[model samples]
Target: MASPALTPTTPATRDVVLVPPAIAMVWTGAGRPHEIVAVPGVVLGAGETLVAIELATVCGSDVHTVEGHRAAPAPLVLGHEYVGRVIEVADGVRAVDGAHVQVGDRVVWSIMASCRECDRCRRGLPQKCRAVLKYGHERIQTHWELTGGFATHAHLRAGTAIVRVGESLRAEVLAPAACGGATAWAALARADEVADVDGATVLILGAGLIGLSACAMATDRGATVVVADPDPARRALAVRFGAAQVADPRDVRALTAALAATGSPEYDIVLEASGSPRAVQAALEVVGVGGVVVLVGSVFPTEPLPVDPERLVRGLITIRGVHNYAPRDLDAAVRYLRDRGAARPFEELVSARYPLAQIDQALAAASAGRAVRVGVDPRDAHRRC
Candidate 1:
């Protein structure tokens, strides 16, 4: 006969029993992720903690993985954007800031963990460390099988910075701070820590989470902002987020003027977050000479465009690519959400919240581009505590 069942109390305190592996949406190399009933019960490893995920948001990169456009570790859990409360921690465990991350503290962790001894990390580029481990993108063979956020409980690995979020922010508002918001913040960091944005004309190529977040940050820096997106709803939302001007991407006038600098002063900065190859090519074309072009969208293989080598050389364009952000970027993201979340319609970006059982439905809406971000509660289907 099976042993007596383990029942944990509310919020899953440290002394709570080890519940069975909560449900997790496993991605197994397909156009959609498969909802697998994960084997429950996660034991805390040394310097590691078990976090009961309170909220998780679907990211565009996760969508790419589901669509097979981006290759990820198969048989892996697919979400990394999440906010949760620490329920259990191993002995000697503490956050990067040296504070003991106690149970019940609202938290968000950086997506990628790096070894400080790595050359890239030593030089301050941990995001690209030779042996970086990114949660939600790792294989099941990693330290913990339940490392991703598409589960009821996530294993917070060592070296992962646990940034304490302000208690006033809602779950949806704080969910993307580590991934989407952090990526946006890090990309814009190339602009002299946003100090140069004051009085500068900034044009963003997408109105998704990253783009809109960048718009808010840019406005905070006193930049004149214009945003472009084909979706009317997104354009409206962008305007609400502090864009001075909004334009449809298909507009001939907007496209022509974006990079030519012929009819108007070319934008001082061009941010490509549309995840579209066409947008990237257009960005290269639209910026004026000496302008900076920052690419944040994780656009994978697509039809390539020919480049005018001499034209590129003459423009003196500074094109930079940013992936999972550095630690400082995550700090900025938390601060941004904490300060401006109340005023901005951060939750508006989430069209609807869906239970994990209906994850396929959520993924459908996300793929259709109807929702900018979709919230998933693993406990929605099966509550563990």
Candidate 2:
């Protein structure tokens, strides 16, 4: 006879089943604190999977929602950057590599779950599908209350691109790959499509998680990278991540001098991840003729940036904006982290950690701008920081 199927009560399954009353932190609005409450166990749908969140990092976009910088559905679960272990897999589910998803597998999923038949999906931009269901941005519903990483359990819905990660990878090193790392990969991929990244002169504005990841990726590809950020700590961190030179974005002279020292006086590729309007303007100005500028930030509302039509015509510059990320980008991100994470200071990118119940402190640490990324330990949901 065939072996019996493993039950939820199995010792191995203990990793996914919380002690009792699975809890989640609910973000009510901009100025209010999160509410800790028990959430029901997930009832997986067809092609869905249930994962117990191992570690979740507070992303800048999460801070934006909490601070009212961006508009999102009220009372949502506000986290997207995380890594988890699979608890249960529904029928007909496969990973990005076309392998069947199994229980007890460590995984990271795409930020946005898209309907494959949508126009954007058909056009090769599934990240922007009309029926996209963003994990952290969705409203709470009875059927899908555990949609975000701030919770102990996330119900991975159908069409969500899941990639199985290695069991050996540290949670902190893998969490940011969901958003910051993947988006940066998407931006660089765009630049590579326009101009080869190898031996390219690249300028990355913003030394935060995305910026620092881009810096490391560019340098890994043989590019001479210059990173600009207002934070001294982040700049120092960027150097460790493989930036050939670092500068203060606020100081135009320092930026200009760095570019001149690069021997080109202009960047072949400029990646803007700071979300600063001035930085966006600066990216356009410093990019060389036939250069490509990939804007990976600026998700929030900002003042209109004035652009000169004559400059675009004369410089032959290309400007592209990358939001969330494509599935292929997420695939590349996981592989990159799995392969190069040990060589670079990728683990240093997550500077702080807090238990899920101490989410307020976690968000505080994240918003304080001192940490590249702050993590939340969902397994310690009831513990102190």
Best by TM-score: 2
- Model 2, 1-385: lDDT tens digits are 1111211121222123445656789999988989986774655666678888999999998988888888988778889999999988876789999999999989999987777776788898988877778889988776567879998888787788899997878999899999999998999999999989999999999998899999988899899999999989888888899988899988777888988887765789999999999999989888889999999888888989999978888999999988888888999989988888788988877889888988888998999988889999988775531
Best by lDDT: 2
Candidate 1 structure quality by residue, lDDT tens digits, 210-300: 9999999888888778888999989999988998888877664775554344234777788889868878887787776777888888457
Inter-residue clash pairs, candidate 2: none
Error of 1 at 185 (Å): 0.5
Tell me how many residue pairs clash in candidate 1: 6
lDDT of 2: 0.85
- The models' CA-based lDDT, in order, is 0.76, 0.85
lDDT of 2 at 272: 95
List TM-score per model, in order. Answer: 0.89, 0.93
What is the Å distance of residue 50 in model 2 from its true position? 0.3
